[model samples]
Target: ITVSNIHIKSDLAIGEEVMDSLAPFIVLKGQDINTLEGLSLRQLEEGIFFMVSPNLKKFSRLRSLDLQDCNIYLQEGKTRSRTIGRAIMVRTLSCFENLVRLDLSFNYLLGCLGEILDALKLPLEFLSLRNCDLNEDDLECLANSKHALSLQELNLSKICQFSIYDNDRISSNNLFKIVFCFKNVKLLNLAQNHFQDSSIPSFCEKLPQNLKKLQYLDIAGNVLTEDSTLQICKALAKVKTFQWFRLTCSNNLLDEALGHLNQAHENAVQAKQRICGLLSALGRTDIHIEIVKLSYAIFVDLMDVMEL
Candidate 1:
């Protein structure tokens, strides 16, 4: 059953009852229940979470759940009647054993990730936790999750950074560990986070050796410099499977970083051309073939970062 962009306030209860009776894959989005009609995003999210908590068990055959931009939270200092904790959601989620895709992005779920991960039983293929204020504890749970090896696409973009002094914020080392979990990940989005130049070395160091399956990588809108860019380029040079790479790096030093990249590209192309010319003049057909292979390798390295 699919429902979207509707006013279901008057019959909300009845609708949920009917939905509970039928164990179908349910989709609810942009809904305006009567009690939640004029509420703010956060309030609406709370309302939806509460409304769905009691009925999640009814959807035994649920396969996909998308609750993006709902601002769900594990509100504290409230009774069970007023608030739903992450554990409850996790327990409820585990009931959907056949679930494959789960999207709870654009929410404010800070902490409680350990509990959630402990309860996850679904073999999810696509998971989006973008802009959810994820922390180091969350990263730890995700790193050890069984689903990590199976997920083909993982989105952690715009995860809140709180503050530089915040102890719970995810660091470069934590990010590396989280990244190390996925062996078959083809697409990874880490845009709009607090990654910086200091984080580049660790990230490069911990990057998996067998990333030939990766096709798209987005590390845009972070704090980076020319050195950081070079480090990323060097790291990417090791992976020959990428088709698209985007690093907006819209920080203060973008121009300086870009200048360094342009110079590197120029030097690399010139050196390759010179080598190719030398090989051709030697009348060495075998050497020419080797030079062509070398030039293609260099081209692949520059192509990914140059487009950014």
Candidate 2:
């Protein structure tokens, strides 16, 4: 199942039987093929994008699919506004009737989300489109998709990084588009999206009311100003639910590449504690902040910046 770096042929066409037979053995990353509940297609040529598993008739119950960095994008002649949706990859994904977790990270899906959502039969509970070269309009499509009301977890981490050539970064307005759209999201990860403290202070004021059901928020890796960080602290105080939600923020500085990570974590902890202490002194002791580390799905173990 570890089919990486294979240059798919131009005339490649998989029949129903071959696709079904390959489906069961398609769920493996590194050495764990024992749990055959998902399929991960990664590190392949562009031709592999459309020819991998388009006809998995026998694999109807497959619930998870990971197509990370396979250079995914819509084919030529396909426009976003047109409803002529027969994209090969989208059609392939429609085969999964019970898929709840879908990770299409590290590719180029600029304006293809609409067709993918149209092909899906059920509402996805967990969706990770991290670093897929998505634009504002693509986010708009996902926001208005059929799964918007039912989607619980969304990982848009690193989408602003774009792939190498796409120089455009996701702005704060685009960030709030997700907030204003996915109202029922419980876990939201916007880590490493290049936030420069332009409009976050004002947006933090509305964060509580926007994502009322948010339980775990990973805002780590974006270097916001100290005042912006404090603004987030004040915003969390007005969550109304008084329920505990895990929060993580970037260490906001780095002396070297991954070298000052521990210090960053320590510094973040101290900064948050100082902010919360100030709030407590002003009779805002209704909230509690603690530090803990946990692994987000597929990402590295981020030192939990703080907890509440």
Per-residue CA lDDT of model 1 for 198-227, tens digit only, reads 778877765647555666777765656646
User: How well does each candidate superpose onto the true structure, as a TM-score?
Assistant: 0.63, 0.70
Off by over 4 Å in 1: 1-44, 75-84, 208-210, 253-308
Clashing pairs for model 1 are 9-34
Q: Which number leads on TM-score?
A: 2
Model 2 residue 77 CA deviation in Å: 3.0
Residue range 1-308, candidate 2, lDDT tens digits:
54322211122236754453333235322323233456666554555555545434345666777776666655335466332333566667887887787888777766667778778888999899877776666777888898887888898887776455443455656776576578888778777677667777767877878878766666665666667767776776665544343444443233423555687677657866886786676566765554333223224422221220
Q: Candidate 2 vs. truth: CA RMSD?
A: 8.4
Displacement of residue 5 (Cα, Å) in model 1 is 14
Runs in model 2 deviating more than 4 A are 1-37, 42-46, 55-57, 75-86, 162-169, 240-266, 278-308
